[model samples]
Target: MAQETAQQAPTTAHTAPARALLPLILPAALVGVVASLVFVGVSTAAEQLQHVLWGPLPDALGVGRYSVLWMFVMLVATGFAVGLVVWKVPGHAGPDPATLGLDARTMPPVVLPGLVLATGLMLAGGPSLGPENPIIAVNVALAVWLGRRFLPRTPGALWPVLAEAATIGALFGTPLAAALVVSEALAGRPMRGRLWDNVFAPLTAGAFGAMTTTLVFHPTFDLGLPTLGHPHWQDLVAALVIASASAVLGMCAVYAFPYIHKAFLGLRHPMLMLPAGGLVLGALAALGGHLTLFKGLSEVGVLARDPEGWSAGQFATMAVVKLAALLVAASCGFRGGRIFPSVFVGTALGLCAHALVPAVQPALGVATGVLGILLAITRQGWVSLFTAAVLVASPAVLALLCIASLPAWLLVTGRPQMQLRDDGTPIR
Candidate 1:
């Protein structure tokens, strides 16, 4: 009996090594492939849908002004989408934006279908949320789902971290940023060691996702400048001032968002509330002469590409009206993310700064304002800085923007307001 037992022990130990190796390699590889597929599929689908919808909708509405009837039609369409999400999907149609923080660890599989449907509806109906956040959610959810189905016996900690990181990598367009965000999300958790093993998965997933996205969507990274422009001494000083101001404004927006959303929730009916919000948005858009509506990035591009055409007053008006419209749209239950609106707002603020100080470069001010807002709202200083730098087509501006964002970060961190709770509650 003793010899038999000893023989069984060695056999068991030998099998354990093979089993362990299988779990590590197979599950990790599966996660990478699944996450990459989710990223590519969702990213391609969203962009194609956007182009198809936007092209015909505008022309069909006619070449003239956005009429009240058309505005109402859009409002009803948007409201219907929101109503479907709120009523149909589980977990109340995915994570509440007001409550999301820097944490991007493992989210549930439910987030995948919810995000895809919600994002598709919003984009189709012309609500202003960007596809990037939903893409992240979908990819992460897919990874988690794949991990669960294929590697159920594997250590739970290993698969989730790897899958999430890979999903982030695919969504962010930069694997390094995806890895950093995922690592940061895991910072306080007990699974730090396992997280190290998962790093390679995300990197691979991100590379695959990026390649697929580039092929399908053909996203443009170049903003048409020869390196981020250098900042003059005056431009540097102005950037500091603009960034500081943007930090304060961003905090205000963040704090107010939840309250606004809550207020809309109290309206009791999507049909009524949605049209009301649309009317308000339409009015605001008219106030800004149509430049403030329909996702402001194109307008921002126009401003950036041709700064000479817009005066300081126009920029300031556009900034104020766009901010107000965004607040109303979000508060009234429009399905969208705040990133693009924030970027548009930041660019307008930058243009306003340049108008006030002609000696300061417009590109530098744009970078500074964008970085400041991103720091205050997203708490993602590095990503914001990179975005600002890229948008301005100036490496020197990027450097200065990074430097200026420190004080902006300080201001944001010092605020006592709470943004979100773990269970997806938004605290105003």
Candidate 2:
């Protein structure tokens, strides 16, 4: 009997992690569904607002769609509206968006309304940022609040992980993306139990979140580039050059991010800072034309569909203008995330490279450009690599992109990230 007891103890130890997954399944699925629903609801509201603000309202005013003057006025108005919320609302829109991301400190439920309003206003007003950061914050806070009421035994930290997984999966339209981003985050941290134990719940949540978003919105991605059948040795060289140059450009922005945030914060009031920032962004949008406005998702498709149609100079102008928009929106009190804008800038850089050289394939150029820029901006190799691969939608170039990332990663590893200090100061 004593011998049997010893054997049973080892068996139980071996199966503990697997058994843990079974009980977590329901909670994980619920988190995924709830998180995705919140994201969809907010995004839908923003899209409707966008259509009205940029469409029917303009028609009522007898102006053309996205007219420069209307856009300028609307953007300024958005700034004031969001600033009012930040100044008057319960949570001050959670935190300054310039200093936040998926992995930031978790906020309370009281912050949700402010975050939603700020995100909606910024999205509707055509800020060069995405709903990622603000949306994630909202979902995370909601998940924690719900978990406390319904899942009394669950760890508080697990809710953040689940919320991040669900939101990232929904945003990227893939569970793999959430996995890559989270694993990259957890890679070097101290390990206490089996790694799969930590990964199982998040993966389950992310998968459901991705499926829910896909069924609801069906976001589009069409590059119109020729299929990349196979990679050549020359492709490697081109990728290296393009990616390196993009890394340098991204580093310039990264180093400058803190100073820009400080300057805007120095305004000392959202009332003053955001409207002024909006004016600057409006001027830039006017200079770069309509294509450089917005979060750059649909605009990226526009750029990718006709890489050869634009002159090198045109592409350069778009990249520069979008980069400036990203800086301003982040620093100037607008609520949004940096990833989408960085992707747009990267795509423009790749298109510019193809325009200049004509020898590099558009897919190779775009993928490598995105990889370098995202790596520098996020400082996460797995997320950057996955995003670049997914953007071009070409599996053939994956190997070359993987190789290209190494050099880019080396360039950005020790650099300052785009996040800010808690006191609104730049982290050096």
lDDT (C-alpha, whole model) for all candidates: 0.64, 0.85
* lDDT of model 2, residue 423: 73
List model 1 lDDT by residue over 1-428, tens digit each. Answer: 99889888743211233344444655555665566676566545655765655456657757343554554466456666666675577755565544543344456766556657766666555454455555555655665666678667766656556655565555445566556665565565554235554355545555555555455546553445334454567666787889999888877776776667677667776556666676676667657765566556666787777666788899888877777776776667554556667788888888888787776677777878888877776776556776777675555675677679778888987463325554425542
- For candidate 2, give the lDDT: 0.85
> Poorest 10 consecutive residues of model 2 by lDDT?
10-19
lDDT tens readout by residue for model 2, 28-111: 889888888888998899889998998889899899777789868987888899899899999999777877876856788788
Error of 2 at 391 (Å): 1.5
Give the clashing pairs for model 1. 129-336, 129-337, 227-393, 227-394, 228-393, 228-394, 228-395, 229-394
Best of the candidates, lDDT? 2
Residue 301, candidate 2: C-alpha displacement in angstroms: 1.0
